[model samples]
Target chain A: MGSLDTRRLIVCRHGERCDFCFSTHRFHWLDKAIDEAGRYQPFNLNLPRNLPKRRGGYDSFRHDTPLTEMGYLQAKLIGRAFRDREIKPHHVFVSPSLRCIQTAIGILKGMNENHTKLHIEPGLFEWMRFCRNVAPSWLTVDECLAAGYPVYQDYIPVVKETELNMNESLIDFYDRSHLVSKTLLSRYPTGNLLFVAHGATLDTCTRQLCGEAPRSNEEFFEIVQKTPYLSSIEARQTGAEQFEIIGTPVPPLAHSANAAYDSQYLTTPGYANNTDTL
Target chain B: MGSLDTRRLIVCRHGERCDFCFSTHRFHWLDKAIDEAGRYQPFNLNLPRNLPKRRGGYDSFRHDTPLTEMGYLQAKLIGRAFRDREIKPHHVFVSPSLRCIQTAIGILKGMNENHTKLHIEPGLFEWMRFCRNVAPSWLTVDECLAAGYPVYQDYIPVVKETELNMNESLIDFYDRSHLVSKTLLSRYPTGNLLFVAHGATLDTCTRQLCGEAPRSNEEFFEIVQKTPYLSSIEARQTGAEQFEIIGTPVPPLAHSANAAYDSQYLTTPGYANNTDTL
Candidate 1:
């Protein structure tokens, strides 16, 4: 058990995504999965078996995509790590992006905290510039609930979707994230909290809380690139409005990807090219 | 679903393993997870939540470690891939190793073939040299069933545990695998058969069926090292006694591992290292 005054927050990025990992300039999952008949055929193993319906059709996944199978496993591993380390969070907040929401689900399932519903905060979404100055149509709370996600239906979001500024600068994005972090801390007062959001959430939310100015646009981009999928950071509140970033409780998970095996290579030099005796 | 003469076999290696991935000469998971108190405490995220009881004790895991979480996911993904491609396996055979058995479980769950029980074959086990010229004590079918694995109760393996030759040469190992493959194909003459086993199983079992001699020991070792986890190969019987290796139904799954993030890196250099206002 933590002390009554202890306040800690851990922020994590979403897992591997299909669009970012598999999409090419000419080809995207939206084009491959949904055919002329409008039927979804999963041609790839990484693609999700079921995609949740959004108001703006499935093409909306161009900006907002679901996590790959490995991505979900990565998130679940972190959640299990948290459970192994006994880093219990009293409140869990998430970005409304499908990837983050799916990551939160994997994490909670890993932690065996199935009952803890995720508080989807629109303020936790990534920078507007990444979304091409347009907010992606995220799945609504009702849509998420209908899709069997464990969403906190009664709780209101810190930032409404309509309030999101598509033209917000990098500094403005940082300020928004800081405000949401601060507001959540104030509301919770004295318990561990978890945030499942984008790569920049680690810096955007915690930098100002630790009394540091936001990084320049160039530096922020560098930081985002360095943040790997399922990477996490921890911050502990020590005094009034003061928090210190600390080492994560778990070690980073690592594994090499398996390449496709071509059976042609398995052929011996002297063997009959065609083995069948017809 | 096919002509009565159709006979297809798919050979797959087990998923990622904890021992191979995490174990070192100085540090092994067996020592860390099990304490002097004889109680198991999973210190790492990749460690299994519960280990099945074996006569050789937990140390038995030194030779037969369970699959990592990623391993399970890999197997399940392959299963899902089979489902996606509509490649149904009428029968499944697994190596007696714990990793292979666990992988079989994940694959079956992914294929949604919960009713399909696994046939544990000692003959399907890896080369004796790899096990250091000693047959390791494996989890008995009863023990596996008690642990809730879907093992076929009535089926008897072609090779018994006591029949394993610890001093078998490389050629002998190939012959053993070939015998097992031949026996299985003869038993199930028409339906699609799946073998969930070791790396060399792909070559060992199918080499003779395809009318090829086994590779030299050096070549064999190289092949094993090159064979990645969850890699699979497919072979179809074209004649009464002839089989031809062909392309797998599903593409290989790929993803880079995420590196762990340290919170110390997030601190701005100019800011106070200590944020607390004391």
Candidate 2:
């Protein structure tokens, strides 16, 4: 019990997404997607209105989505919030994606620690579905390091075709999330750990912690209202085998300027201002 | 059945080990190690006699055990045999270990195809147990390319300490091996596949094909007599859900010169003869 209180987890969703993802907003099929019985099940193909079209015969940019400028600022605000509260984490973890990297970098800046060893966990990468597994020419570890991000020296992403499991489903992702949870417990044991990843990771990882997620539709929306834009949840290990979400999830609505902020719209400060040279 | 016959799996274990693994011969407990029931059960702590003593307080040599000269030669011989028999694999899969790399390289040389793109699959790495998880200085992917081996341009190893599941047991190893098998089937569903890895991989992967591994003491020895040295097994996917072990597992005794070979000893032609420099 004493040790459980010492170990805490800050499960966070990466800030707003690339223009590619945002332009294809939810009004097209989001309500329909939720209304369908498929939402209760896993891996049901819920095609949205604005699915990014393949750029060409072999367009890598069709995927490998990056965080928009607004997303960066949201991450920055979260990092600043931690700094403002004097919350010093023993380690910071992020997924191996451009968006997560930018968000982690922004958060790092907010924490005022440029050299914090940021671990790029491939397991935390956004769930692959509907052929979303095909990645673009990803930024290399050296590029991350050169770009002033302190990605761990040994960081490596899954690259080989054989390493990419094709039959991966939502269940598989959930299993991986369970694996990640076990890994966290075994490695950190006792420390303030920060995780910057995806919405699925948040749901799955938190489920592994407290054994359940926001089950009710209203509850799910309530917990995820600010996610993928600017949301964070705190899970405190209450026992060796138990965890309790301590702090409230600070979703985007609370951090953003006003209610006028379009909930469905992906607000960005524009790409020109954000130099994403890769 | 026709497709199954064409789509076969040739699972081969890496050959031999460096002086570090060899000098610590079984007078410390190799022979007796297998004799115990703990062997049948799994997770038996059988520390080798000469378990490479650290050269100093920090010695990376303790774990990144490379292959010896004989091991390389054995791999070359297997490659030559495959080439002689005209058994050309469309793709070559190998673990990202120095020994596996050396073996794969030696095999590539023997096959006379120096440019075959090798996929470094971390899923195929030697099983880890105890503190053996703490890796030694691993050879980088760039080093492989510099050494003239054609590694995939986008090969990346697994990262993140928490992503490394510490409580992994033999069951976990089997699960991973099963994942590797599934990956092999789904990725190249209709091609001849080759896996170059360790004995445990051979054991678990074969189990995925047919059914179980050898359980009896003698049967276990028979199945693994020459594994991790120079041995090969052929598995043909019989049905969508069935497989047949076609060719025999070519154990070392059948390949090595005479009965004079010491099977228990990690055979080497001396490090002076085998280059270890990356």
Residue-wise lDDT of candidate 2 within A6-58, one digit each (tens)?
67777677765543323334432123223345231111111111222222311
Report the number of backbone clashes for model 1: 0
* Maximum-lDDT candidate: 1
DockQ of each: 0.34, 0.01
Instruction: Enumerate the chain B TM-scores of all models.
Output: 0.91, 0.69
- Predicted candidate 2 versus true structure: per-residue lDDT over B3-63, tens digit per residue: 7656677777676564333333433213333344423110111121122222321134345
- For model 2 the TM-score comes to 0.38
Best by DockQ: 1
C-alpha lDDT (0 to 100) for residue A25 of candidate 1:
74
Error of 1 at A28 (Å): 4.6
Q: Residue-pair clashes per candidate, as listed?
A: 0, 4
Q: Which stretches of candidate 2 lie over 4 Å from their true place?
A: A1-278, B20-22, B25-59, B130-133, B155-162, B213-228, B249-278
Whole-model Cα lDDT per candidate? 0.82, 0.54
What lDDT tens digits, residue by residue, belong to model 1 across residues A1-278? 33544678899999988887666677786787798988776656667777888787777777789998889988889998899788898899999999999999999988999789899999999988888856578888899998999998887778878888889999999999999999998887767989999999988988898789999877777677667788788888878867887756576665545554545547644332333210
